[model samples]
Target: MSRQTFLEPFNAKAMSYAEVARTFVPSTKFTQLAGAWNSVLVGPRGGGKTTLFKMLSVEGQEAWTGAAAEPYKQTVAYTGVYVPSDIAWGTMLESLIEAGQDETVGILFSEAAFVTHVLLSVAIGIDRHVALNPVLRLEPGAETATDEPTQADLERVIATIARLWKVQPVSLSPASLVDALRERLLNIKRDTRLRAKLKLTDTPTQEYLGIDMLESASQALQAFDAAYRRPHHRWCLLLDEFEVAPMHLQKTVLAAMRASGAQKLLLKVALAPCGPDLLYDQQGSAPPSQNNDVQQVQLWYADKTEAIEFCQQVFLSRSSIYPALAGKMPSEVFGTSAYAVVDDSEDAAQIDLFTLTGRNKKQVTEQFQALAEKDPTFQEFLRRKQIDVSRELGMQPSDRHGNTLRKIAPLVAFRNAYKGKSVGKKRGVKPFNTAYSGWESIAAISEGNPRWLIGLITRIMSNNDQVQFPVPTPQQTAGVQWNCQRYAEMLQSVANEQFGSIKTSTPIYDVLSKIGDYFHNRLVTATFVEDPPMSFVVDERVSDDVEHALRIAVNHGAIVCYQIAADVGGFPTLRGLRFRLTYLLAPVFKLPMRKSKSVSLSTILEAKPETPTSQDDPTANPAGQLIQGDLWAN
Candidate 1:
């Protein structure tokens, strides 16, 4: 498969089965799974339950192509079953019986069922071959082949199996016929001709018992039943993706398999996150009866350390299900690296990107220094750009921006003037802000959701050197203006996607637009001010809505949120937060706004009384005013 498609199954990363089992710290649930019994994997999206399920149900399936086969291969001796919801119940049952006809082919049952005294376990759809089907295959006029299997083909196979194992072909009574058929089917051994045709493996762990080709359907079931009950050998059954199966069928199948006291038959089931809930929901409020007895296994996320280790392992182990980029750097460019540096100072002289090196340092120090040293003109230019945007956006002397900046001047001063450098200097490193500083913007935009932060960083890095604007030969004013406009449009689009639609009813659009305008203005203003406003707050009345929207935007990775103390009643209340408007809206849809802060009645009603006048009089008879007389009042 091509590299892009190769990693599709493993795209879930830490949430996948192998990673979760390996990296998740051991818990009671993990220990329970280690013991025998059925299991229900549970977790929210991205929690890694599915990954764990795959690890247990399909051994060696995820191994790298052409790798050495597993030692002590856990050949599936029983029938393991996977019941996809899309497949009809009858179709699923049929496939299991047909596949199980090969006495030597260990049947993995996707669902459960019972026979008289003999519990015939079946693993419904355990096809290692199907799982390994190539994702891409050739087609005429196709640029590349795709490997998606046809569901219709699978259903046919299932139907074939059901017909073969069916008993009393002409009868309407299913229970007795099914019972008789189950006995014959379980005892039957593989047909020699069928075994030879498939080039069946001869390993003791993998027996390929052939099925009778010439025998009619009824005759075959009868022969299989007689042979299956001999008890010389055991039949194993595996159930997979149980959550997707019909609840009634699942309960019936599981109940039957458990009832059969046969020693040789073993049952294994694969469950999804909601497996338990689905099962209980199907059963209703009544407590499970004495007849119901099945063990359960639960899968969940590994501990933080385990999760980190799993992530590292996923990056390191290139030959497993998800191979890494050969010779690529193991450490993430945007991860919390020791190379970053932070400083709190107003002196521009203190910042230098090139000479700085230390663990857990902020990038601001080195970035501010580098910009101030190598391209001081560019640094000054950005500051002026920010100031201009702020003024143009109407964030003026008494606006929210002005108020927030006045309160957090010290922090802005520190951020603006500070200089620091990364540790463990390496050659060919990009400038600090350009390289690692965007993560701060990402974090600022995403608020703290690692997923959103990663996505934003990934997008930014992907397009970092795309030459988005025209290069200036003479640096004319028109060219600069044109480039700036293009840049602004791009920034606006990103902001709109990330935070604009968070609330349709509120003024989020106005807020974000103002913020973006303020950001552009600050870049320009920072050049001249002792410390320009790097952050601002919305009106306190809308703080909750703003905060909630900001959080959603951040989680989806639209922007970063930081707590800032403002002068509330003169005690430096920490009531405000700040973000980069552009990053918050970078990943969602973009709709243009006709205007920000449209004029309305509320704006015009300055100092108006809460209640309206009771009545209106044209005159009180004093000039044009009507006078109230004592007689008229009586």
Candidate 2:
């Protein structure tokens, strides 16, 4: 397959079972997920939540390679059944509720349809495991692989589940039983759709109503265990797209997940970080507590080391398919680091002098002097460390082993290199001041999301099939900007529905665009602003409309937020929240891809908005005294 051919699987849901398993790359979180505990796999969209959930299934395990797969296969005590939620289908189920007589009956009908889909997946998963175990040897214990159940035993188990699920099979075989379950689901959908279409006011009902979803699932697993001769075999129910599931159903599933330990069932649900509904079913009722009842495994790539390593592994794995990229590392293709030192007289495109260390003595001495002379903040930083800016820089001083100055040299080089140069359009539109590139920058911009990383890498590699390793800085910058533009377009369209009702509704894109401009002014355009605001904290008294807008922005990945205050359920209360724009758009806004201290959101919104202008008193505020106290306050 070509490099482009391999890129399709980056959208993990679109790939087949075998394809996903074949191309799977395991990360540290995979080990955490493979355990028997009930875990909520939380991350932004395209952060590989679906991929990880799919890998837990039997097919994924069967096609998995390397030393990692063997240990996981040999010792795993549970069989994974992957149940992917379809939002469209869930929406249909929700519509069906309106056709019912009362709210209680409506929910009953909706839950029945949802569970029918779940049960069908469970049956299908068991069938695949049974048929493939003999050849794949994924089952625990060496003898268990060859100990295939007799046709009669399998048929009896199928019959028992069919009866428990209130479905009659056309035949006493696994495939036939699956067909019956599918038909059952189809019938319910057909009935609901018909009622909804005719606007039926009569009491609506489903044949499978009142069947406890958890009880049926538990009983079905027991029947399968008895038939397979493994009396205590565990089942890991890998539920993907938990946020798409109806609100009531999510609560029920979460409640069941909390109590699943004694039932020999392990539930691992994959969901987006933020959603409209709280996980709790009742307003005042306590929700399932994290750590004590459930394990919350976040895949946000907050740890730079882990995210960088995983990005490298994914690059290597995906690039192996193309002959030109076979032996290349990300550094070899995207450049060694995000920033490099060059001669003070040169531009970013002048790459012959580029060095990752940023310690070329002449360049460092010249760049340091230029920045210190123009901006007094840099000079003060130097004075505080008692470092002579005129001296030729070679290495970190013994006296300042862990000091930030030595580490910030490369950043200084970058800041000086593009001080006033227009590299590309600002935020992919207006004339921008600088470009973000390099292997480390790409990884940071991805924010540990595999989809974003893959998109950026593919954009870089797709245009040049025969492109050589160590791609030039200019080409990398172009590709990064292109990727940023793509995401910027999407961000513009988000939150349209949530803001549709308000006459003065602010499009999320406009809000972020305004904020991005503000950040650009503080970080790059201003003369001598120190410790610019890279993020912001919201006050608790935000209007409901604005809070809802913010929540929608968060769920859509335009804004990345972290909770500071927690309730009994360990969920954030959306109060005093700290957040930053999604770094994938860093190139668009001409901002650095680093997280820093926050300022107040209200201050930014209240301040007179202004486009960034680089011609201001270039060196007047040498001590950062001109910076607004409330605008950049920690």
Candidate 3:
């Protein structure tokens, strides 16, 4: 298969149910989501939300085979019904609801239609489960039966559900039952539009709209369980890409899920990190509070330790498919990073002292002496920390606790060592001021995003006909930069589409451009300031336009948001938010792929915007050389 196939793995929605399950590598969040409770899975676009949801669905579970899936299969406590949505469907529904002659009538019709849609999914999920009965059984304590549903039993169950839902099926089988619900939903949509066109305020729904969908769906599930001889089974409604649904419909679903006491019902919803503000009621009732009502599961990993582990797990699981990659670990292909030594599947490698300091003890001492002479800050830092680079670099430390070498040595060394080094005059000959190599660096750039991690590795493999183990550092840097540049350009394109035409001094692109330059300046300044500011705290006094643009930047993954402070209850509040450029764009700005000191968003915005510096400007930066057109156009 083509290497391009590996890139497609990042898109879970595009894959078949079997492929999704087969390729999925279970993460820590899986345990949290597998519980028989309600949850809202929030993450960036390419994070593993859809993949997890799909794996929980009946089809994915059934298609799943082999030892890797055994533990997860055993965790199945409820039958999952996956309800997928898109922008087109959501916009259409929103328009239909808005066109209603009467607000109340429109809401009722939309609510009923939503319920019918869920029911159709539920029936199909149960039908698939029934087909596997008698032959395939789930882990112990699941709602599996020794015998499959007989024709009479199936007919009776279908009749019970149809009666409960106030619908009629032309035939009695489960497939027909699913068709019946589908038709009812379609009819409701049609009647709603017709009512709007005719300016009729009377209720448009032909069937009863007063029934509680949550309770009614629960009742239908029970009927199936009873007929199949698997009583008291629970069902989870898996709503994927939920942010696409109209605001009113989203609230309706949330309200229903919160209000209903249906013991058999569970809920799992997935949406973007900046999805529409969830409100159970426009009036006074409390919104669904995390921990109190639903578990808020975030798919992205910000912590470096956890991020690398997850990246390695995904690499191992997916790489096995290719014969050439069999039994190989990430370190073998990507090699060790210069910034930090990350634990790999193969035995951990020792950090190379020569890379950070010099070729020998005498050279290392002279390098540090030269840096301390030019930079007083480095002199003070060395004295304050009692760091003896000569001894530390040339020999083992007497006390490991006092040795900051493990952490600060590489960063400090790179800052001073690469000072004043010009970008090589020849294209592709002179190297970057800093290296973005090693598995650790790759993980940092991937930003705990599985799709990104996969894409970076795939691009590297594709660039080489047969990649050698422990691929060259320059090759890794090339792959990393190639992906980073593409991402930067993609973000710029999205910015143009979102805020380009808006008459503003700081379009989203400008904000990004300004911030990128500010960070780049910190990295290449004449003075060495260890732990330069990379993160930013948004000030409340910013203009509405600027604030909106920043929010868009976050939603598009141009920047990442961190909750620095929280309420007394430890929940995230608006005041607690912090923002930083995604590390995936680190190479573009020639900044370190690490989070450090934070400055205020207002600070960067308030600074007089200079033309982007030579090293950082996409117009001139080697990283941005591939970019065409005026990316920084006013």
Worst 10 residues of 3 by lDDT: 625-634
Q: Write the per-residue lDDT of candidate 2 for residues 141-215, one digit (tens) a residue.
A: 434334557665677788888889888888876777789888987787777677777867776545587788778
What C-alpha lDDT, on a 0 to 100 scale, does residue 280 get in candidate 3?
A: 34
Winner by lDDT between candidate 2 and candidate 1: 2
Off by over 4 Å in 1: 1-35, 44-79, 87-302, 319-329, 332-634
TM-score per candidate, in order?
0.33, 0.83, 0.82
Model 3 TM-score, all chains together: 0.82
lDDT of each: 0.31, 0.66, 0.65
For model 2, the run of ten residues with the poorest summed lDDT? 341-350
Q: Distance from true position, residue 87, model 1, in Å?
A: 5.8
RMSD values for the candidates in order, in angstroms, are 22.3, 7.1, 8.3
Ranking by lDDT: 2, 3, 1
**Model 3 per-residue lDDT tens digits across residues 1-634:** 4656654435888889988877678878887887777887876678788889999988888888998888888888888898886444353345565665555565666667667777888888877876666334355566644476565677778888889988888987777888888888778767766776766765444765766678788888888888776787788999887766666777766765565434788888886665455533458866666646777786755455667788888888888877777788888777666564321111223344223444444554566666666656567778876766556453234444223454454555445554544331112224352357877788778887888888888877776666577877667778888888898887766642231122234567678877877766555443344455666666675675676566566656677765411111112223325667888877787666654556666666765543223322222122221221111111
